[model samples]
Target: MTENGAQLFARLETRPCLKDIEPQLFPEGGGPNHGEVVELYGTEGTGKTEMLYHLLCRCVLPVATGGLEVDVVFVDTDYSLDMLRLVSILESRLNAGSSSSAESDEAALRLCLSRLLVVHCSSSSQLLLTLHFLETSLSSRPGLALLLIDSISAFYWLDRCEGGASAIRQEEKLRKCAELLGRLLSDYRITVFTTCHAIKKVYNGPSSGSGYDRPYLCRPWQRLVTHRLLCSRQETNSVAPSAGGSEEQSRRQVFTVHCTSSGSRTKAYRSSSFCVTDGGVKFI
Candidate 1:
């Protein structure tokens, strides 16, 4: 049975796109759409995971609180997910909204947390299995709109060592993972967000060689990425006037996120700066 054009357009209207997650990061207002993959790559401590948390929060919160109110499946391969940190940020976001009683806030927090499904994977094989499991889970839950995998390159060196001199064997597991991900995207209307660590040193001058910062992942995984975000961090000094008429010097870390899209249409490259505070990521 083929659907008519009117029915197809109606179905498209109901699909969710994350263009409003962070306008500052995606100034063009074209965020990750359904069945699309977005990759974030950077060195450690550059706030890649923190950005994931922010995006996850946006998906899980209710519509009344300015969130998408959709379910999220978060696959944690690096074992770096801090539930306490996520809860703290969620609490702050909830509190910043309309004032309510403590009981109501707690209930809202629980409701938001309920929308998230967290799975931990210790190895590449486990990660692959997890994706298979997610297919069944997504089928039962129509509200699941986002899938997050923190640091998909967590097992890069391990696979390399195990493969020895065979390049084909080295990328075998991830290649399969990429294939499975593509199938999942085709079967479901969900968006994927994964992180890749920067393996090579970053150079800033024009003399830098070509392919210096190219992604080290296999072609299968790289080909699935529709948006690539390069993250970097820098430290800056801030001086404030104290009540006692003395100057106070403090240092703060700032993260710069630049995004490039590789789709049918051209999009202007955009970048934004932000700082990670106790509350969450505050864009500047």
Candidate 2:
């Protein structure tokens, strides 16, 4: 059946807008909308995974429990997802929201976890296949509003080695992956959040200190990104002496996160600082 122009416009207007998953990082309030892609790139140990966990919790938990209450698909390319850590953070968030008994909290936790679908991909080929699978899954589940890929650049080196001297062949897999992502966004209108690592260093460049490393991925993947968040970390001054003495200072480390948006309506630059704790990434 075909729809008229007025009908199409009405349907578009009825589409829901996703809530801001990380208000601390995007202080302006509007979060990634449907069909938008957000990329977080930085060096290792910069709390990118921790930030993903935070956002994951926000999507999986129920609305009454202070979450967006939408389902999420997490693609673990680096094999770095710590389920125990994610559960701990979710439990803490749930505990803070209500004074429910231990048994009830456990039940709530289970319910939240049920909404998240985790897929593991060891190589670029597998990642591409996984996205194809997700397209079918998304078509069946309208509640699935977010798609996350931890370190989309995971297979860069391996693919480059396999491609062997041919630049086009080297980037072929990732380029296809990006094309699939674009298709998924267009068809399902789901938001995407992926992480990238800083594989190269830049000197005297515009994004040198802005947390954006040299672009190492293919142009297709780069162009697919609607919002690029450059992440970086640095050790700050030691906290004031506490009852634990020097022990506290050594264990605690604070790092700042800088975010810059390209292709956004406002085209603004924002930065936020956060520290990773036993629970999760705590913004300051």
Candidate 3:
């Protein structure tokens, strides 16, 4: 079903793939299949957080502006949320326009604020339990619209996996986590936005730090995400020195969305220069 209880993209229904539908640059409804398991992956700080915050603002927007007048459920496992930043994005929308529409937007904003809920977690087990509780909570109150799990990979113990024999155990652990997440997706039709760490490995044989390439997501988990995206950062100071672009060109972040399994998938790509301001990510 389409996000608003509409019959679309389901069995026996004809619908185009997300990539085929050109993504609206700054709008929330621009993307495809909202109430599905969609994953956003990147190394670190490549606008995943920013995009998520922007989405939060959009949910508060009135229906006139292509936004669903609904609520947001943010599950912050990494404690990466910034409250002031949230208010900034909400206020920016109100300030963007004036007249009767602005008044309506403000009203919608207030209502959404009342409905919004956040759950913070320090451990993977807590995160899982909280989500289970959320499922029960939402059934009682159906207005809890979208559910976002920021940085799912952060829950795992990153440094614990060294090499050789230990790698097998790590994979098994990862596989189990993926299984749990998959079950949740099937049970709930909420839009699941998860931020993942894209692993990268280098061959240290003869070429030191050379032949570096992008790595895929973990297997079973990868299959669960119907729509997957990669957020690549611009050539910032932390990035490689020869990371492309000119002297005057400011760094740009990439948002590339694709599908899971085989077949042709839509590649809705976006590359824009942005920075983290007091108001979160601002497109430059």
TM-score of 3: 0.66
Candidate RMSDs in order: 3.3, 3.3, 7.9
List candidate 3 segments past 4 Å from native: 1-22, 25-35, 99-108, 158-177, 203-217, 235-284
Error of 2 at 163 (Å): 0.5
What digit string (tens of lDDT, one per residue) describes model 3 on residues 82-197?
A: 87788777766665554557676667567757767888987666776776687666555544556777877775565234323575555564566667656655544455667777
Is candidate 2 or 3 superior in lDDT? 2
Candidate 3 residue 151 Cα shift, in angstroms, is 0.5
Candidate 1 stretches greater than 4 Å from native: 1-15, 201-212
- The lDDT per prediction is 0.87, 0.82, 0.59
Error (Å) of candidate 1 at residue 47 is 0.7
Query: In model 2, how large is the Cα lDDT of residue 263?
Result: 70
TM-scores, each model vs. reference: 0.92, 0.89, 0.66
Return whichever of 1 and 2 wins on TM-score.
Answer: 1
RMSD of 2: 3.3
lDDT of 1 by residue, 1-284 (tens): 35655554454456577766678877656887778899998889999999999999989988887789988999999999999999999999999956799999999999999999999999899999999999888766777889999979999999999989999999999999999999888767689999888877566777765432578889999889999898889999999889999999989999999888877768658888999989888999
lDDT digits (tens) for residues 150-194 of candidate 2? 989999999999999999999999999999988878867888888
- Lowest lDDT sum, 10 consecutive residues, model 3, at 11-20
